[model samples]
Target: ILPNVTIRMLLISTIESLSYDSQRYLGNFIKRNDLPIPFTYYLYNNETNLIDYKINFNLLAEVQCLSTEHLIIQVGSPTTIGLESLNTSGSQSLRSGCIDTLFGTAQIDQNKEKSCIIFDVHGTILSGINDTIILALQQYASLQFLYVTEADLETNFLPSMINNSISKPTIVCIFDDHYDKHLHDEHVNLVQQFTNRYRMKNWSHVQWFLIPTKNTWLTQSDNKQYDENERIQTLRSQLSYILQKINQTIIDPTLFRTIFQVQSLYWSLLHYSMNTLNYDSTCYFEVESELKQLFNDLSDTTDNLLITTPISYLQSKIKQNQMDLPRRNKTKFVIDEVQRYENLLKKIDQISDHTQFFIDLLTKRTYMEVLITEKYLEQWRSAYEPRLRSELINEKHKMIHLTSELKRIEMLEKQQKLNKSIDIQQQLQTAKENYEQSYKTLNEIDTKLMNIDMTIGLFFDEILSISDYNSY
Candidate 1:
């Protein structure tokens, strides 16, 4: 009863040439059709004041509506006002971001563009049949497309994500105007501005349609003229064709619910068309009824199988040499390693100059020859005694000692050669071998001790035995 009371509607167009005489003919044609609703169309006319009718007259002044209740249903150029309601993650932008935005890929294909390229969202494109068409299109062209439905993205695209990295989503895409007004007005305006900005570049960037179900008021004798059943039959035929195309194929169960909402909304409009149900009365009875069933069916069918397209996108670009392909980010791993390596190189450079000075002192051999052992020890102590209590060799003293030892060896060798004795040479060789072996063994022992200390420290928190070992 409420649905029949006064079904108000308004259709907005941008064509400037619609004549005033055409308006009366348009009204008569609509009246002759016996439209169930009180339909009021607001089209572009230079003579008429369209501002008062269009819901969004705050901006587009001259192009407006006459009906107060009906909202702006359709915009001729989505760029004008229709797209203002929704955001555009356009195919071009989609192309820039990733590989295989199938629609964007299609845009690259001159053949597909030259042919009929319809972005059918409502009836033919979204559910089952639409997916098959998209798949077929992909076979022929480089395509870029994105989904814009109200289903859970995680539920719909998760399997594709698992199969390939290119499936990672970079932006949000939706068919709705705004996400329930929770979004700030500023943000909404920004999104409109964003869409307009893109539309200016590609007039085809956006497309919108508000499909109102036209119905006739049932007449007593002539009521047979109302093809009510034809509507259901047509809807069924379209749905069946889609189901047939997507027969063995599976889609995200979440996508089913989303697609179901679109279908259900259309289905609910049926009751409204018949003047039996209103919008809030039962939002979308048909969809609400079958959603769970649809979910179960899709879930049972596609269980573990992955889609083919996103998987193709996920393949490594180096392997394919595919241009405009999506790339994976290894930032977390590579960036940290690069930073650590740079810091290590800096520390190495700081120690290099000190090492060079020590090398020079050894080659010069001046400090050891001047030795008073006490004075040599005092100088070493002044440099490092606070850090280590032991009177050990410093770089200066070590160099001096090596220089003195070499001099002694030379003197002994010269004397032994004059005497024609091999004993001194053999003895010196044996001593050098023994000294090298001792140094190697000492280094090994130090390493072993360090490892044991490290092991104990690692276990110290968990093992009380570590404290006892430390005491020992």
Candidate 2:
């Protein structure tokens, strides 16, 4: 096995350009699988300014592929003049993947919108935990900002930054609340290390911040995006915020310490800069591509399915009506849930109407196919549109059902208040749960049903054969 190597020493000029990516080679790698050794890569360009320590430059160019026994190394460029020169003697093995090295100009811009546009992070500049504080960090800058995130929070994330060449200040929001003192301290250490080691000139704000609770999240790189090697695969996350441009007034407390973690130093700095609360906040989902995905998924379904699960959930709630102690709390919850669901359904519809034009634009795969393959677009539409249609139908159904549920609940509430002896609480809870369960079930079933119908229609006219229906 190859001995675990540390960044015992790395020599570079100024890290000109930093891209969070797998180590890139102008060529490829080949190796056998049984060589038990773990591997990673770090690279720098020729002008990396590390000419003085050329002798200890024990860096591996990269291994290409692996088999069960032999580990193969692929040297692509002439820079192998000073690469990893190691020999091993052990039963250890190297499980492997690509190691990316995207080194270019060292980005020192706290103003992400202006400088770090290639490796963008999210959450810091999207919506806050409070929802009202949208894109606070990025908006503070004069430039328009875009927020992106993948469900996978580890490797997929940084590589995306590299692929997109996103150097912009982005916030990687924490979706989970798991924590450790050692881990937290590590993050704190990283924030301090980069600030001190990199010695960024004219840099003002601390770059990263952690938001273990809702009270702390800043649109700062310190809040989320940190340049640390140990964090590459660590299961920890922080909220990110980048100063897109310098602000002249009191920094938003929302960007720094409040009820929680203080990963970014922006809030503290802002107070010293100016002491006035700022009002210019951000509007959310402006670059509604993700929103459109949900729309697309719903649009693809047939019309029969109605009422979405989210709508039902939103409607789930308790009312102010009194009930017998045995089931009053339960009934109240149901009533409240129903009201919330109704409001959400209304909101979804409102959103749909607001963005219908975008849907029309997206549905025109003809335009997309001009740049992509027709077969691919066909597959995408078939896969996505029916799902979207099903969502729409399910949402409609929820609104319909919830509207009925609400009326029943109101009656139940009134019965308890006016007609003293009605045992409606049990009935109310049952109704609410049933509606909630049905709403979820319908969304799943509706899409399948719609797909079946659409597929049948694509093949024939008035009547669909039983065999065809079954096949779809």
State TM-scores per candidate.
Answer: 0.15, 0.21
- What Cα-based lDDT does every candidate model obtain? 0.29, 0.31
Clashes of 1: 19
Taking the tens digit of each residue's C-alpha lDDT, what string does model 2 give over 30-76? 11221212222123436764421111101122221110111111211
Error of 2 at 29 (Å): 19
lDDT score, candidate 2, position 40 = 29
Top TM-score: which candidate number?
Answer: 2
Residue-level lDDT of model 1, residues 251-355, one tens digit each, is: 211121111222343345433442332222112223223322322332212321111111111222223332322342654544454455445433431222212
Candidate 2 regions with alpha-carbon error over 4 angstroms: 1-166, 169-190, 197-298, 301-472
